[model samples]
Target: MMPQTTEMADKLDVLDRGSDGEQRSQPDVTAQSSKVSPLDVLKTDLPAGLVVFLVALPLCLGIALASGAPLFSGLIAGIVGGLVIPLISRAPLSVSGPAAGLAAIVFTGISALGSFSVFALAVVIAGVMQLVLGVLRAGGIAHYFPSSVIKGMLTAIGVLLILKQLPHAIGLDVEEFGAMSFQVGKENTFSLIARALEVIQPGAAIISVGCVALLVFWDKVPALKKLTWLPGPLVAVLGGTLANELFQRNYQTVALQSEHLVRLPSTDGAGGLLGALHLPDWSAITRADVWTLAVTLAVVASLETLLNLEAVDRIDPWRRKSPPNREMLAQGMGNLTSGLLGGLPITSVVVRSSAGVNAGGRTKAVALFHGLFLMLAVLFMAPLLTRIPLACLAAILLTTGYKLAKPKLFSDMYRLGWSQFTPFMVTVLAIVLTDLLKGVAIGLAVGLAFVLRESMSRVYEVSREGQLVTIRLNKEAFFFSRGKLVSLFEELPRDTHVILDAEAAPFVDHDVADAIRDFQSSAGLRNIQVEVRGLKLAPVAPG
Candidate 1:
């Protein structure tokens, strides 16, 4: 949802200029009027849709793995997000899909609840909540969530992703019987790391390491650098496929088995495409945890959608703004459809939406086409998709995790000072130790405390130079600040001259006025000189 636009104008400027670097007017998209044909739109949006499909394909697979969900769930989310949202949403260029950020939440939710079906029900509930939010026109709700707390949620998820994917990377995802029965979160994340190291699969480890290296240096390769239409993930998957083929041909002993690769159920069976249905358990709805999970999903997904929509607008070449309530309603329907059809929770993903824009997609057709591509892939490409090794997917997630919680993010938060840093750090630690909802609650309380302190602190300014002191009232001073006022006078040095300046203040509470008057009258006890500038105390009540 965090759509990045740093230096985007410079990158997009070349597209607006001619070969000679002379500027030209932007195309009048409506010049052709309503007469624009489907074929023309397909021609314009198809290639861009293909680009988005390539970009979204591997991510869907990888995010499903990261979330401990059936791989088809990811594709289902992609299809619904792509196909459904664009039909109703005013955000023409925003691409909705399964998000990397939600992986941690899904994994923990399933583990705590001990059932994917139950989790699916939670997703359905979340969709309903989003629909209600839309109906209430609560599009402005995103403004209420503190950015520091949100950043903390994401940073913790990054840490969780790295921890969660490590075992998969090393081919040590041996689930103990009933492990999901009591599993919760990163409390055991490191323990899994230790276990993965003990029984590492050489083939998977080698492939994963190589894939990570390739991703790290992908743009450095001269030929690959120019292939802007080709996504790095697709390249990594292709490389892994080729490497597996080489192993199959020559290294029989270490060739990765079927268990190490993607396990998409074949579409040619008696059930055909419908055979992959992993429907929700309706009985789980009565559980309190399920309700809690639903609320969390609804809130998080809504925030992500709103933020990504805003981000997409900033980078849109056409400079269009999306209607937030309509987008929310669209997301609600998308998630509702996805949940009913055995899919992961869906959100408007910044990465895919921004990628669509970068790939020259300017209309809703691109999103629709991308969804159709996902649906088709599941119907026909299951055989080829099953050959993709888990290690390569692991590498994709590792890169994603690294980017989400980069080292620079840490230093940047610290530089924002304690007001921002305290909540961010607290949220990170709490989420890592606990679950998403609990941690965010703790962080929000801390953030709100800081906000309250700041509000109070803003009412006055205190400065002292040697023996001279100044108390500057800013706009207003109330009863809550009387303790602060009294405390300030108590700190006076002997024979100090004090100036209580109220020129800027239009209203001073009677409590504050009384406190100032009492302080002024008693200053002679400490040989302190008290002068009130442009100030009048309230009339004292007769005793």
Candidate 2:
């Protein structure tokens, strides 16, 4: 064979082998082996960790508050996510933590289960379920979701963050921090906003507005963008805290109270840390409710983690693929640890992962360092953290939400046509109306409906010229199309020459092939001459 033809054949052979699920051997010098030294990685990782720490700290507190769990629980989850998960996960840039998406589930589970400790037990059980799922190689299930539905999910999450955070931003302290569901506390998203409008605290509103403006300015201005070392959210938090302190000292009327700021349990030493940790109530293991919550948590957390891993991988500068099963295993271990230590259930979070990527995190060290920072902060700077206003954190999340559901994303989706746009919109609406899992389920149903409709409508193409008729079966002529096929066969004109062609079809189902053969046998009665081609005959039963 010619050299070019030989190369083409080799490439085809590789592709064929890949299709059979065979693992390809790598070169002696793998990508990771040739990477930078640990010292160089540390240089990049430390700064990135600081940025992620600044981003993660408030989210941890906020999500915990939203879940109706102890605020310290979120911190514990963050610590485990950062300190433990990275040690096992293959995704270098992905960051795991207490997820906002699970706040609603945690909140409901706690209420139903009767205690945080009981819910913690559920989380532990959920971790075991995740480990099982990983071992079963179920991580690939995430790939089955349509791209439009996934995008819709991200968009819906963004909208939820903005809507949920608005009350906090405007200084309404009634609702918990990081509530993502439509209904939070006693009020829904809309009612909460309406209530906030009536009872907006001037100091909180001012700080939130200023912080949001600063974040936007920092993001958009080219000169400000050059200062990458200083993350905008960190600046916003520090500046907002100082501004709040100033207001408290001078203008008491506009000053935010302690209730409007973060409240972390102070630790005096190792003894204090140990005392603060609440162990799970292992007695709840036998309860059906506990097992239900465990299954739900495992499914949701696994889905979210896989999706976040995919998103993070896409944005990684090195363009590395994360091992999804390994990620599941790591997350399982982290959640198990968190549950034992009184933390909220953890998952790979998009917000923190994206922040890590944008902050130039080169390795897992960044995540490890961020966890260390969380540990150190809780140990020494708990009082200082309490001074940071919730409004400032709300503002930061508002920006994060905007990035996820930007107007441009909607426009781009619309341009992709109705098939893509319809499911996308449905998912968004469902999520807005209900919750994440329900929304995704609704979207998947709609996407499948579209697929079925397409399949049914395009079963075959028919054309006629005088007495000559051609019926060309589609690439997928399956049993599902039997009804249409039967109708088309019956409608054939008398005394016409009918050609039933399946030569181009990759798969002609047994039922379809049988139908074609029946039509061929019956054509004589209708005075039609039928020529069936390329369909493999099914085996006949022995008389």
The candidate that wins on TM-score is: 2
Total backbone clashes of candidate 2, pairs 3 or more residues apart or in separate chains: 0
lDDT of 2 at 465: 97
The numbered model that scores best in lDDT is 2
Off by over 4 Å in 2: 1-47, 108-115, 282-292, 314-319, 358-362, 514-525, 539-543
Q: Which pairs in model 2 have colliding backbones?
A: none
**Tens digits of lDDT, candidate 2, 422-541:** 999999999887877788889989988787778989878999999999999878987888888899889887999998888889998888888887887778898999877887665444
Candidate 2 residue-wise lDDT at 449: 79
Q: What 10-residue stretch in candidate 2 is worst by lDDT?
A: 15-24
- Report, for every candidate in turn, its global Cα lDDT versus the true structure: 0.75, 0.81
RMSD of each: 7.5, 7.3
Least well predicted 10-residue stretch by lDDT in candidate 1: 175-184
